[model samples]
Target chain A: MVENYNDVKTINTFEIKERSYFSILWGRFKKNKMAVISLYFIIFLIVVAIVGPLVSPYHYTMMDYTALYQTPNAKHWMGTDDGGRDLATLIVYGLRNALIVGFGAGLVEVFIGILIGAIAGYLGGQVDNILMRFVDIMFALPSFLLNLVLVVVLGRSLFTILLAIGLTSWAGMARLVRGQVLTVKQLEYIEAAKALGASNLTIILRYVIPNSVGPIAVALSFNIPGAMMMESGLSLIGLGVMPPMPSWGGLISQGSRWMLSYPHMILFPAGAFALTILAFTFFGDGLRDAFDPKTE
Target chain B: MAQNILQVENVKKYFKVGKKDLKAVDGVSFALEKHKSLGIVGESGSGKSTLARLILGLIPPTEGDVYLLGKSIFKASKNEVKQLRREIQMVFQNPYLSLFPHMTIGSNIEEPLRLHNIGTKKTRKSIVLNLMEQVGVPPQYYNSFPHELSGGQQQRVAIARALALEPQLIVFDEPVSSLDVSIQAQILNLLLELKRKTDLSYIFIAHDLAVVEYVSDLIAVMYLGVFVEFASTEELLNEPLHPYTQTLLKSVPVIGGEIRDITISGEIPSPINPPSGCPFHPRCPYKKEICEIEKPILKEVKPEHNVACHLY
Candidate 1:
């Protein structure tokens, strides 16, 4: 029997070395060239935002009253806006604000969404009915309109802005979480957990949450750009980062007052908004592809 | 009287279909004794799996009670029912889908121990290793994911997971039907060996009479949400009663050149508008005039054998 066990040992060994989950996922994600390109662009953009001030020699809010609206050049590359501040510094500051709102608000929404959805979905009947109804009510409301109203009521502070965005954004995240939770909660592993005398709390936290990280992570990635856009939109309408505290949106908002006379002002800010959204979109695609079973 | 461990009392599960209600498991009943096997054989819509699910309390019945070790499982408090959960674990059809992909083989086995708060993490780790050895997975596979193992290996891991709590009873829902024939034999033998060591009782639900006959102490034949025949495996095979049971036996295709009329006329009717008296009347070939009007209650034709047919 011992001598004949060679085949079993060999077969077992072969199975043990087939592939790791992370490796399989990573391999699949890397195959998508566009997602890779997006990942690079997003990372580069983040790094640029962090190191913007050290690389450039200008305080964004510093006024050069005499040199207001200067054209693009080496000294004041990409030109100045109506406020006579460095356009470069404004873009960087805007980049920082955009990322902050995008990620900060996103984290809040996803955390709340997962908690609510997981509980609601796992514990069906009355609990599911009640929670889903709340989610539906929120989902039925126009998020953009809600954000607009919230900003008006709360006034324009960074905390208030993130809070408003997070509050408005979580409805969609919650719906996605609830759907994933419903499907995963029914999986045999979860049933096994319950059969093992695992408590509802233990099952949700241990099995359901970890298993759901794929979709949740993907959803978070997709939501960031949307949050950034919302931030940019609010700032453009003067409900975001207040005047003299330069943002790409605030800068462009000011520059747009002069319209065709100073087209660079509108162009640069719009370009920043488009670039940020595009990069995030690609990064999101990479993450979505990464979690798929067939990717590897 | 027969050292009965669990008794399923007139269980009924119904779901709303549009405006009307559809009875899934309608007034089904059975009983099992400790350290014995009960085989539940049925077609896809025959509600065998649903009965298994109800017995396991994965889903509460629309109307019925499952007594585990003679304690009401469905009506029990959360804490009380948890005891039943630990006592009665389950092995599923697809082991690959049953085991958590994110978890390692060891962690998967340690779950029940952690849930029941039986032992500390350190001791539970040892128990997991012991379980792994019992099921033939080595210590090296402890850190491996579900996707790393073959179908047979994965099934073993799933079995180890069910065995983690050292439960008295295991509800195996077609545990071997998902694998290759050779692998099925190995798993079946493993299950028998496990029963020997622990004296574990099993409610083995399967589609194959051949496989069920190999592993069962008692067999119950179900058709369209009800049992038509139930007896000891040997007796049920040798002296089969009920038309449905006969048809099912005929359908059993072996490796040899054996051929029989496994094929019965007409489809199993929808449970919503079941053939007035007997649910099996449409597909049941032995149907007489009385078969269409009044349902035949299960009557014991022998000391422990029961059959529910007009002919019986």
Candidate 2:
């Protein structure tokens, strides 16, 4: 038995590289093939959104009346829309705006969520009651209608759309973060931190926030896609990015009338929108499993 | 003579659960001299943990006060209470849970020092390295996260963190219970060696009589949130007076001696609605009619030996 144990120990003594918490998470994330592929796709889309329009053969507003409602051809790879604008250029610019709205609103949602959630969760009692009641009211409201009203009132623009979606959508994220903070704050480590004389703020920022990062990240991933889809929906109704500014939703809405005549127009923009949203969902699902503390 | 390192003047902690109040620690009192170890032995729900929390000021007592170095913690100002933390530390039962999961072992050990703003960055690093060395943790584990290390190693890191500020009193709440039997002995021996080399005092809480016997200069046996008997280690082990204490001793299997029959049965009653009169009366084999009607206060039956029983 002793010899066998020694042999097993020797076999197990091969060099294993040291890993930090993030590295461990990355290792788990890498194990999911679909998530990894989705992550790469999202990165590619972001890169395309940034650089695609800058290198497009024609400007988004440069119309070609001769090619109006044209099908896919050498001159216009994805064909021309009703305005005869290059479908490729329109799609690129639309993607850029959509990406901005998705990520920008995502930032807004995460910030507000963490701030309200941490405060409410850490300072329970009357404060919790007031804040959570407010959250409950927000949850009761029709989020899409609220977004629509804000956009119509504020006027259509990238900034307005991002704010409308972000401000209205943060209630769910706040509730998620609040639940995470509640559980994390009750752990013995938090009590240990308190016994070590760490202040309430330090405990919240260091212990509560770091422990809740997994759930928050997962929530943010889903929020990005949710925000993007919401933006598309708004744009489809003609209140999103406005004219002269191409967005996936605006392109899809314009191409719908000419769908039978030129299917490529709606197909290109809608396909990009659907695929990006799917990528984010897959990535979010992957993150949920990867960041789960109990997985190991 | 110098003052005792710690004094608990009838500290009590009652938690409101729904409509009823659970008296977790009902007016428990004790004092410890410098460099002495007081072992508080009790099974689950005996308020041993609550007593530790009260002493540490992690939770406010419902009544009474805890004094550290002649200052009442409950009566002290906010800053004063915060300052008191530097003089007292705690090692939790589960080393894995007690440690900050995101931090490396070195940073975990250095946390208390950093929190108190003690020493420069360079000095703190050196102090952490020295502590790790003293605790028998390897130098290579400095960059390792808490989960990377084994249970024994994580516990050593915990001890290092507790010792960073050189506290006068350290509370060990079932610190060795989470480890395996072999690791338990190793950690207990390390604690004993640490006590021998330093002027540190301890309030060691554990459910195991044998483990407590190895480290404690004094012993207090708790049941249902109150101490039933208190005596020196040798005195309590050799001549336990309270029926509950004897029942606990008999439950432990002796190495060479014949195992005494267990007289106690059934689980401990809930603190919310404990039995009338003596809390141990229902489980006490030598119970009398008087034991059911009147509560027994801990009183001395011998020099420095106390028992709370109607027979006494």
Candidate 3:
């Protein structure tokens, strides 16, 4: 038996190199048509937000007395707001501001969540109990109320709003990451890592965190839209981005006052806001589907 | 004579389940010589896997000491324990779960070398490739993820990873149980070849008596977290003195031989609240009055043959 084993020739076939993580993700991501369309729409929205103001004849802060509440015409596209500021310029710049807050606050939330969740999950025992209990307490308070309190105390600014939304939103993410870590830690590879003499930090950063990225990525996509909605909610109550800065939420708030006479003002900004949120939701769902290992 | 590589002295691991203590490993004692394999045979929950974990230092023993090359592991400092990991490695039962699914096979094998800071990046790659060759894993599968490989292939990768550090002792915890019968023979042969090539000592844990006999020099038959018989492989196979060991041997299907009746009865007792006297007395066919009233200690019946039974 040993002789026969030794006599067998080694197969030396060479194949193409393995696909990278991004390429594989892109391959799966392209299969869903709605997700692909949503991605393109988001990208287009971002481009318009960035470059649209620069190309327009009117600036967001520019007010013309003659064009007040003008309907859509060739001279001033998408009409003019009550302030006579170009609605197109305000909407585009408003989108830019919303995107900034969404990404900034979303990243902050994910970072804090991952840090707390990874530590809680990897350490386990007393440390896990303490941290998870803290997360549970945080979850008990309505996030909007928490954000409201923070905005009121800190005095509404872009940074304070970002901080409030980020601080309030991470409890859900931390919980998700903690559950994922708990499951991943029980796999035999973790024991194998421990047996191989890997330190706790190295194992957490290299093995545990990397494996938990799929769920984290999905959570992150969902968080962007969530942050944007929170910022909008705060804005509706006069605590959002201060006027003249032109946020989507501020525009909607301004438009609501004139709702009886001209419904176009509310319709324009609300439509934009709804479209942006829908795009994010669709994109996040696609990511969740793409990253689902069971689908593979 | 070869020096002793491992000495497990009266190791006990008890877990607190609610109000009662589960005696997972109850006062097990044994020593393994350098370059020899000691097979521990037992049913599931017999504490065979628990004993392996204790030796690996994955879980701390409730009592007793494990000495590797004359250095006490339980008493070692943090740094000493870290260094001890290099001397011992393990191959877990489920190959699919044992390897990281995200990493390629080559990177998975290279993980330990990186963890220990053993070699440069170039040297680590070369070492991984060499290990892949040694384990008969095709070079082409090196870049593939674990899920891409068959169960047998994944096990070969796991073994190669265990061999990467050149540890003196490798604990095989039913390493072939998840593979097909034909693949089991292949993996067994591979293990035998690796043993011959590296002069590595092994603590092979399995419930299959035949598989254990094929690889082990010394055999230990465990019942309810304690050894019922300890002897040389040949002696235990030829003449098992303990009734538990005899019933276990008869249960192994032998082709073209007179089939003996399977005499063992009763389910294994729960370790949380085991019987007061001998653990096997409830199932032993030759249980006497003494067997039910008092526990039996392992007593030597012949040279290198110890049986823990009243009959002995």
Candidate 4:
């Protein structure tokens, strides 16, 4: 509508600043107050996880034998556990461990999901049928049981647990990404890209994936919490990180034994885990709403 | 003989729908000369869009070949096909859906240049600016996304992107049908101006006979999956030989052309199980016993004029 020919000539000297995709995504993402709060909460959790242990006077392994199962006080916050380890320190370190597994396993799951989904969606027909069938087969197995089995076989460690969670959880993400890719690939712009002589890889990376990023981002947000929950569940069953490492799930399991006598032990770690998952879910939901073009 | 920029030799494209093969484009052949425009007018299910895809090499034909600058596009290797793409481009109908929604107008237009590894960044930018100007897109809109612009503006950007490669032949699949009448005229004028400035051949596909007549040098009337009539624009409009072409011309709401009741009965038959013999026989008012038994091939009835009707 700005149709002045003379003004057009002046535009050559006018440098246009490019607005990157992430900036636009951020602009949309910030609109949801709940999502924004959730994002801040996630950032806070990450910071505490990374820097909390470094600054804490009490280490997760260090135990005070004189004050066993002491309630919250200045000397010991969130009380001491059955082992007389500071529950506050254990909670912080436990949160950090949960987050590591959440993010690490979540990223791996997303990577696998995107690869399989992109392939299935872009190359429909026989390739789609085969890959999607594999996804169906994966869906048939009880994912939690499979993760437990994997942890048991591989000898439970952070690496094996992360791998187990990532391997089992990707099928759902792959299915979600595949559905998004199918729709995006059919858009007229994709055909236009093909006509422009864009290679399959170029079309997928540049157009299809970027267009479908909204749903994928939403899926990623949800996957982190899902992975964290999986890790917690495994740890609760005594198949998670060993006793030396303080995991949120392991702490909750230990606290459950003293549920009647010491409620604070179960309360602190369980609350943190629940709050973290809740924040992620809210953020993921908000992202889904924000990225949904139909919502606008 | 003037150089033929593109030649389609009996190109046939069939899709299997259930147990039957849907003949989307069957034995269609035509040659487009340099700088000449060929308008393909057809109804919704006439395979005009499919024909455009075949020419663009987005989909390969079941039989025959498309020759671009004397090279068979179907038989071309991956590298050869990539090279062939630089010579041919396309403008889709829905401008809203054609341009990449995520990219800025400048980036969308510069995409082909980047894809083909054409000019340096500075050169590509300048080229994009020039194309934007040529397509009547203002410079301020260069950094704007597709959704920010109106339907007409988005189409102009699509045109600019198509022209970025300086392709010899550009297939326009009802480029202006999705815009307002006022906007359609503006875009049509821009296309005409471009055609004059650059000797670019166009395969313009549209269901609107009037719009097709305005821009086409040669007009082909397609019904079902075949060309019912093919001739120069003026001759086809003035003296339409095929019954289908006459009906199409009559259907065009003229300002004050002797108001007479002209109607054709029946619907376009499904391509999957097309009517026996002539595909249009079911809809043809002048259908005879032979028309239902034998299919008529396109034959020259006049110099540079061809028709595929038993009556011919």
C-alpha local distance difference test of each model: 0.84, 0.91, 0.90, 0.91
Q: Write the per-residue lDDT of candidate 3 for residues B177-203, one digit (tens) a residue.
A: 999999999999998998989889998
Instruction: Identify the leading candidate in terms of TM-score.
Output: 4
lDDT (10s digit) by residue, model 2, range B52-108: 999999999999998999898888998998899999999999999999998988889
Error of 2 at A40 (Å): 2.1
User: Using lDDT as the measure, what is the rank order of every candidate, best first?
Assistant: 4, 2, 3, 1
TM-score, candidate 3, first chain: 0.91
- Top DockQ prediction, candidate number: 4
lDDT of 3 by residue, A167-260 (tens): 9989888988899899999999999998988888888888888889988988888889889988988888878988888888888999999877
Candidate 3 residue-wise lDDT at B14: 97
Chain B of candidate 4 versus the native chain B: what TM-score?
Answer: 0.98
Q: In Å, what is the interface RMSD of model 4?
A: 2.2
Tens digits of lDDT, candidate 1, A38-97: 888888878988898788889886888988888898888878877688787888888888
lDDT of 4 by residue, A1-296 (tens): 46787687676555455666566667777888988999899999989988999989999889888989888899887999998999999999889888889989988999999999999998999999999999999999999999888888988788888999999999998999999898998899999999999999999999999888888888889889889988988888888898879998899999999999999999999999999999999999889877766655
- Model 4: residues with Cα > 4 Å off, grouped in runs: A1-18
lDDT of 3 at B143: 82
Candidate 1 stretches greater than 4 Å from native? A1-24, A33-58, A64-84, A115-142, A255-272, B18-21, B138-140, B254-264, B281-290, B310-312
Docking class of 3: medium
